[model samples]
Target: MKPAVTPAPPAKDARRPPYAGYAMAAIGAALFASKGIIIKLAYAEGIDAETTLALRMILSLPFYLVIGIHALVHTRARGEALPDGRLVLRTIGVGLIGYWTSSYLDFKGLEYISAHFERLILFTYPLFVVLFGAAFFRQPVRSKALLAFAVSYAGLALLFVQNMAASGSATGTGALYVLSAAVTFALYQLLAKPLIMRIGPQLFTCVAMGAAGVAVIFHFLATHPFEAIFVSPTLWGICLALAFGATVLPSFFLSAALKQISAQANATIGMLSPVVTILLAMAVLGDTVSGSEWLGAALVILGIGWFTLSERKG
Candidate 1:
């Protein structure tokens, strides 16, 4: 009997330094951070969160469609075997809930919450990623990983400490929503990560984004309608920026980065996003963080850095 062939290892050493991957992850986080500030600015101009998200998705539609069409043409010309139809369906399903619905919830939350506050909650993604990874994939939980997780949560507590004190009561409604968003966002990263590994970043993102765009467009018509979207030029411009700069561009970089980094690393690196958003808010929105917020942001960045940098190949 003939022996079976085992696949060769990836060309680049698996144990090579993770710096380049971390750098790309940082860039992707920066792009994502730009979204909240821009969305807030658009809100100040009177565009509602639903309308803003819809418009952003709409503007990004053409970019994804163009890529998908191009791929279809090229594949037909090359007579390559067709991709599995079920894969497309799965991508669409995840994109609909993960990208479209989660984004809607996030923007809506931003309307009611401070940018700093929103960021603090969002950064909980690292813990969710680690948990999801362990539960689903049985990834090992190291002592350092546990410590990093603890520090990150401590940062989140510090940022929200004032809010919790001010509340003086717990209804659990608002916090529940934020927690839901965080979980969905984490699932988004985890679900897409495997697809990205399978299909490559560009194609996966294009299809997933197209799916998200379609869902959001339908949501806009059902909820906001055409008049809401066409209300003003400033609103349209903000939406355009959200599409290209916030949604489209960042997602591509993030999807690509996922190919190079673990989901846990991606979430950890995204800890920088809160810092970037806070800085942007300060510059553009005239928002200033109190000493506590500053400390919280510092802790988040430090904890994430410790986790990513300390993970040396054994």
Candidate 2:
């Protein structure tokens, strides 16, 4: 009998992406940028950050609860055990820091600075991830990662300097708040890496978000009256967008993306986040964009895209 012929190996260029995860990251990044727009719009109606945050968490809370319960049931039916006590508590802690604290800071900063300014600062979270991950987790800092970091930050620095020259340092308070938000979010990314590996993205995100939701609930109750819910119709509509579009969808997308990609890689892809916020702010809020801002944004885009491509090849 003749020997059976073997099939040829696939071409190198034919390597396929884990599309679901990549889509999640890209879509989630856009949705996150959208939140800044929505929050700014709501703030126009005179709502404080806490009230806006409470509305978002409360509206999005049920979705997280259902997702967590569903995950538990599915795992149980598959004869897989749930997360242990330690993991659960750790998730809660990370969630409070990442979601509750970071988001609160973000909204507060938005009150003082423009949406574009807030987003640019918040986008620095990836750099913070590089620092904290290396320091705490001993994650190797690759040369390519460093190059990408330098390129992206150079862009941000250009924008910051130009904005300062034109507008002065009046936004110092807002910048500080947004910077704190970025750091906490970076901490969240560092904390999430191992946890996502163990418990799966869905369960981990659900648990963390739920913990954050509860914290926000307590905060809102402590400060605001029950009638605070009865905001103007426009603000109410903005709240819905914030809840579903920004919070729920992006949370799922980020969680799923983290499952397939390293947190640093995922965060690097998010370099486009500020661009999205800038465009939205220009259209919705009439924020003026300087020539320097345009050039800076281009640099950021190049750096992030180059890094993402390099990672895919490796």
Candidates in order have lDDT scores of 0.76, 0.84
Candidate 1 on 1-314: residue-level lDDT in tens? 98999999887867687776788889889988888788888889987777888788778888888877877777678787556899888888878768787888887777666666677677767567778888998877777777877887788778666556654333133445566788888888988888767655556767888888888888888986577767688778877888898867887788788888887778778767888888888998998678887887777667666776676432
Candidate 1 global TM-score: 0.79
Residue 142's lDDT within candidate 2 is 76
Q: For candidate 1, what is the lDDT?
A: 0.76
Q: What is the number of backbone collisions in each predicted candidate, taken in the order shown?
A: 0, 0
- Candidate 2 accuracy as TM-score: 0.84
- What lDDT score goes with residue 278 in model 1? 89
Report the C-alpha displacement of residue 280, candidate 2, in angstroms: 1.4
Pick out the ten consecutive residues of candidate 1 with the lowest summed lDDT. 167-176
| TM-scores for all predictions | 0.79, 0.84
